[model samples]
Target: MITNGMIAPVNLTANVNNLNQLQNKATPAEAAESFASFLKNALDSVAAQEQNVHKVNDQFIIGEANVNDVMIASSKAELSLALTSQVRNKVIEAYQEIMRTQL
Candidate 1:
């Protein structure tokens, strides 16, 4: 258990070594690309979850799924999609604001 206000010291040499390995294996551009790809994947996952909820509802309509399960899945998917959209909107707003800065 971690106590409040207790900061653990990180080993700088180990961190440097890890960074060296990462730098050796990938350029800065490659790292940025990987990060962007990861973000895209996360967005895709949110959309997929929404699709799955709709699918469950469709299954229930066709008499292949339970009502309770469909409702639970749909609520979960809806909440996830809403949260993802909010985060995306915030990020876009921040980026636009940054672009508006003249320095």
Candidate 2:
């Protein structure tokens, strides 16, 4: 079990070797496709959460769901949206940074 405030130890050299191997083996197109796939999955998850919140809200309105369930669902949807926005902003930032590179 992981304890609170605990940091897992990592083998830095192994990680560097693994990353170098990936960089050498993977083509730019493959990397782009992988990133696109990951982004799409994240978006789908956020959409799913939003749909769930809507469903819970409707249920609550119909007296089938409790206030607590509605609140939790809404909060989860809001958090998912916030995370998606942050991730998008970070990707944009990275793209801009790459554009500014001389090489």
Candidate 3:
């Protein structure tokens, strides 16, 4: 359930399914792997969204779609990419700070 207060929920079912899948894992290794998988899945989702924007833009140029659809897709893609970038930056910062620890 990621929200930025700008876009309406597009796929609640996908988020619910992801949460359900994560709940079934109990072991430490399973949890770690599930977390990694979750991040990968999120990245894949944003990539798909960016691809959708490109598709919509192309369709608009071809007279098959309109500006509104393209704008919506583009905004969604932009927000998702920004969110992904922030998460990645935070992860890297945490790793670096951990490396600086004494022991």
In candidate 2 the C-alpha lDDT for residue 33 amounts to 65
lDDT assessment of candidate 2: 0.67
Instruction: Return the TM-score for each candidate structure.
Output: 0.65, 0.69, 0.78
RMSD of each: 11.4, 8.8, 5.1
Candidate 2 Cα misplacement greater than 4 A, ranges: 1-27
Q: Which ten residues in a row have the lowest lDDT in candidate 2?
A: 2-11
Candidate 1 has a TM-score of: 0.65
Tens digits of per-residue lDDT for model 2, 27-97: 88876665566556667767777887788788889998788777777777787789778978998999999
Candidate that beats the other on TM-score, 2 or 3, i.e. the better one? 3
Off by over 4 Å in 3: 1-9, 12-24
List clashing residue pairs in candidate 1.
none
* Local lDDT at 9 for model 3: 48
Which prediction has the highest lDDT against the true structure? 3
**Candidate 3 TM-score versus the reference:** 0.78
Error of 3 at 88 (Å): 0.6
How much lDDT does each candidate structure score? 0.66, 0.67, 0.78
What candidate 1 gets wrong by more than 4 Å, as runs, is 1-26
